[model samples]
Target chain A: MSIKNEILKIEHLHKAFGENVILKDFDLSVKSGEVIVIIGPSGCGKSTLLRCINGLEDIQSGKIYVDEQPVIQGSKDLYEIRQKIGMVFQSYDLFPHMTVLQNITLAPMKVQKRKKEKVEKEAIELLSRVGLADKKDSFPRQLSGGQKQRVAIVRALCMHPEIMLFDEVTAALDPEMVHEVLQTMLELAQSGKTMLIVTHEMSFARAIADRILFLDEGELIEEAPPEEFFTSPKTDRAKKFLQTFEYSKK
Target chain B: MNWNVIREYLPLYIEALGLTVKIGWLGIILSIALGLVCALILYFKVPLLQVIIKIYIELFRNTPLLVQLFFLYFGLPKLGIRITAQTCGILGLTLIGGSYMTETFRSGLSAIDSIQSESALSLGMKKHQVFFYVILPQAISISIPGFMANIIFLLKETSVFSAISLMDLMFTAKDLIGLEYKTIEALFLLVVFYLIMLLPVSLLGTYIERRVRYAAYGD
Candidate 1:
């Protein structure tokens, strides 16, 4: 296997909301085109870790480097650094007042100073890629939950970021709607986009992850290839965690 | 009650209607501009300006427009700050109307979900870009109802301009009554003209509110 360039690195990160510590001494590294899936119980800091990497949350200690540039909260270059990172939220927070094409093209045109025609052309293509070509002129409120999430993914992708972060993107969708979004993500992974995803969709995580990481209580308890991690978790914590999914399936 | 008296005074009332409309809308526009600035200051919590704006909003909102006009028209001159009654009416309306507008806009700004901004910021938008592109449009949409209410309130408040001797609709009605002792005719004309000025605004507000709702929700 060829050694790819590292695109993201985090070391000894600590984050807290007053006395409630969310992430403690966490570290992660991602090479170009790697797809990492983080799985854990609710409140295990999976979301916070992703938020920290994107400079949305202030870190109490340690450093995060994206393409060797430090991700510092409130720093002068945070906006520039953020352009290199794309994030899709669970809420599908599309601008309700804007059409799907406008929502996808806004950041590129306004922030990146890209030409409106070029950005709109790219946005329409991305919308088509997500099976939303006919809906580009539609407002967000006019779309279903699954369609909205796909538009959000296209919105982030328009930035051409170095890495993409998904924070439980499918968790809020209807059960049937979940597959369409997950399928879009699968195609994104197949295209070799570097991604960090936090999800409770165990099967999807297992299928897409280059490596699966098991986190509990703000710490990484286990890390392994998806097949190995699913079959024989290193920690009893992970084993018990995987069992919850089994019980749910029954 | 007296058609001939009303007919004799109709032209004066029409002239007063024009002045009232001009002054009322000028004030409304200025107030909206002032309100938006004050609201942005409060929304961003811009240090000393926020504190100053809070006091200004409280001062104007708590006082009646009548008293504010009196101060600007009557009191200011005693202190050597003489302004035309027209200017006084517009300024006073701007001050009081601005305060209400600020609160209206502030509520609209706060009503937006934090997730909207979080989504924008993560898209690599600068803070101001997030506000102007994402936050402000939604906030303005949310504020429409309150803003229209404020406009009607300010327009009606123009009735108080007569107290400062601006010859608005109310002043014309009173002046006609005093001159000819035809109180019913003059008062009836006053009511008709005020309605003529305000009904369109009310209807327009409803129309705009419906359009904004449809655009936002597709309902």
Candidate 2:
């Protein structure tokens, strides 16, 4: 894809927590409307990289350009940058005090400064899209795990962001509930929304991602289209990790 | 013992009780304000302010209200800051009430969901805005019972001001008991005074608790 068409450009990114390095010399560019799923061993900085994309985490030495806009070394524009991006976390992160509809409408009402009536209408519409329009008045604690994750997806979508970042959003859900969230994500991928996900669900990653990235120990060991990436991993760790199916079986 | 005396002193007794209400409300308002401000300082770990507030709370919480009242009314005058006994009551109540109030608010804040802060931060709310808008509105609900309890305690403690010559209800009793030498009548009048002071407070407290429960998470 052309540089003008790419939505996210990450170059020579390096980060560490004190002495423990997480991402080192990493480089990737995401084209508009493509889905990229990153999978790796625990503590490989997959989630950290997603966080840096939306300015949630600061990269130690390098740059992340979102919508061709640099995210590194800036002040409060991080919020403006963040306004263009939406993130869904592993915990669902829905405000328990708010009803599902209130949760969906909160950001749009506050940050976007939309009128209350308009946002409430939009919230109901978004809820229908996630198949929980009837649950609008329910608090988050009242919802099931699958229902909560769906609400979270719609909440992120309510902002109409150019890029959506998912950090293991389904990792906290039960096995029976994972399929509903994955289906919502699959439907989202079909909608041509630019997305970056760091998830442990390998088969879902294989089914939906345009490109699959495998990392181990802070390095991108392999990048390929799903069929080739899974059939033939290049690195020793990738080959061994996939054979063990460490995350897949679990 | 006499119906005529009960009727005659009834107006004066009621008058004294009204003064108790005024002082009690004033002291409560001041103490709650002081408590909230001090709790905020302690919550954010402000420089030396946290340490100072911590010691202040401990000092007040450990000491009796009468000693603190006498100290503020009589003791501080030696150092040139002589406050009236009424002012002494307000000050003493604030010092003591605020300590317990701070603890109540602190626990209320602790009961809040941690992600609520992160959610507020992600929304670009300033730190103070996050607390006031997102955290404290909900925390206020949790803290109301404790706040009302502390206020009731302060109202009851206002009786101690009679020792320092404040004209609050207990002081009126002191004067009446001395003037009439009617110990039973004076003591009995005080029982009514205490009931009137605390009854409304308890009822208001229960009302606030119910309202807050609805606001916090009631169906």
Candidate 3:
């Protein structure tokens, strides 16, 4: 898909761990308010790509630009770059010690130096949006998997990240609770925030992905709109991969 | 056998207890602060600081407290720097306590999540803001019990100050033993004196432990 309105640009990105070349010269562009989904077999570097976008994993060579500024070349302030690029990890990396409300408001009150009343007001509203308003005072360990993931999304949103990266957020949830998290992401996408989701659930991808890019062993095998990408998959890798799509049955 | 025999030295006991408390509490307070700073440095490893703090902790923590007291009290004087025995005792406790404090707080700092710092940073907080608002507050909370336990250890360690001729409880007890030849009564009073001082530190440690657990996990 053409990305003339791209807000995030990944150019010649490369990463390797020892002998393992996870991502080799991979690149993509995310247009303004676009919802892009990345799907790949395990160890295909899908999560690493998302992590690199948010600056969690460094690119060995390439550069990532967010909002026309070089965000990945070790030039942009890390905290500021991170503020614009929010990430929800597969593990829901919430502060275990903080309550749900505190988790959501921590970054806003501290980094934003926002007024306490304003932060709390927005935090409560966000929590209520996730259907977790009553759990504001509860610690992370008390919440269900779905609740924690929703809180994680809200926590990321509290920073008002320009681009939100979701790394298989539903992968860790019980099968029954996966819908809640996907539904939250759907709502978040509807809010006009740029979203990049790496998920295995084909149906979820098909429903929300503006452009679906399939990765296999670090190669971007297919990049097309979800409809054509899922139905008329062009490449042999994409066809074989689609033929082996057992995970979508559940 | 009469309690009145010890009554004559009641005023002395009070004075000795006061000195014990002063030296012990001061040493512990100073040591905990020093140790925590060292631990933070080594744990987070701020630029060029880890090595210096590591060496300081190794030097103070590995050496015996008595040896430290002797070096500070006698060696410093021989080096043309003279300070009082009280100063030496407090200094010794802090030096020794600092080593252990670094060890305790370091683990507590490491135990906490790096994500917390990320969370704080995403909020646009500076380094100090992250440390105080997220890192140090949680670090101190988790390390309080260990700190109290260390203070209790410091309290008992201060009894060794009598060796340097400080007027703390143990020295006074030694003087009382010498004058009365009632070693049994003097030693017994000394034990009673220590029990009274140390019980509170232990209890306070337990209290802080419960408080942190309740706050963090609502236990």
User: Candidate 2 vs candidate 3: which has greater DockQ?
Assistant: 3
Question: Which residue window of length 10 is worst by lDDT in model 2 chain A?
Answer: A241-250
Interface RMSD, candidates in the order listed: 1.1, 2.4, 2.4
Interface RMSD of 3: 2.4
| TM-score of the first chain of model 3 | 0.94
Write the residue-wise lDDT of candidate 2 on B1-219 in tens digits.
Answer: 666666667778888888778877888888888888888887778999999999998999999999988788888999999777777777788788889888888888878887676655555444565676678877888789888888888888888887887777788777888898777777787898799779987998998788777655635
lDDT (Cα, 0-100) at B89 in candidate 1: 91
B157: Cα error in model 2, Å:
2.6
Q: Write the number of the candidate with greater lDDT, choosing between 1 and 3.
A: 1
lDDT for each residue of candidate 3 in A167-236, tens digit (9 for 90 to 100): 8999989998999999999998898889999998999999998899999998888899999998898999
Steric clash pairs (candidate 1): none
lDDT of 2 by residue, A123-209 (tens): 898788888999998888788999998998888788888888888988999999999999999999998999899998888999999
Pitting candidate 1 against candidate 3, the one with the higher TM-score is 1
> In model 3, what is the error at residue B54, expressed in angstroms?
1.2
Tell me how far the alpha carbon of residue B198 in candidate 1 is from the true structure, in angstroms, after superposition.
0.7
- What TM-score, to 2 decimals, does candidate 1 have? 0.94
> lDDT score, residue B49, model 3?
89
Q: Give the true-structure RMSD of model 2.
A: 3.2
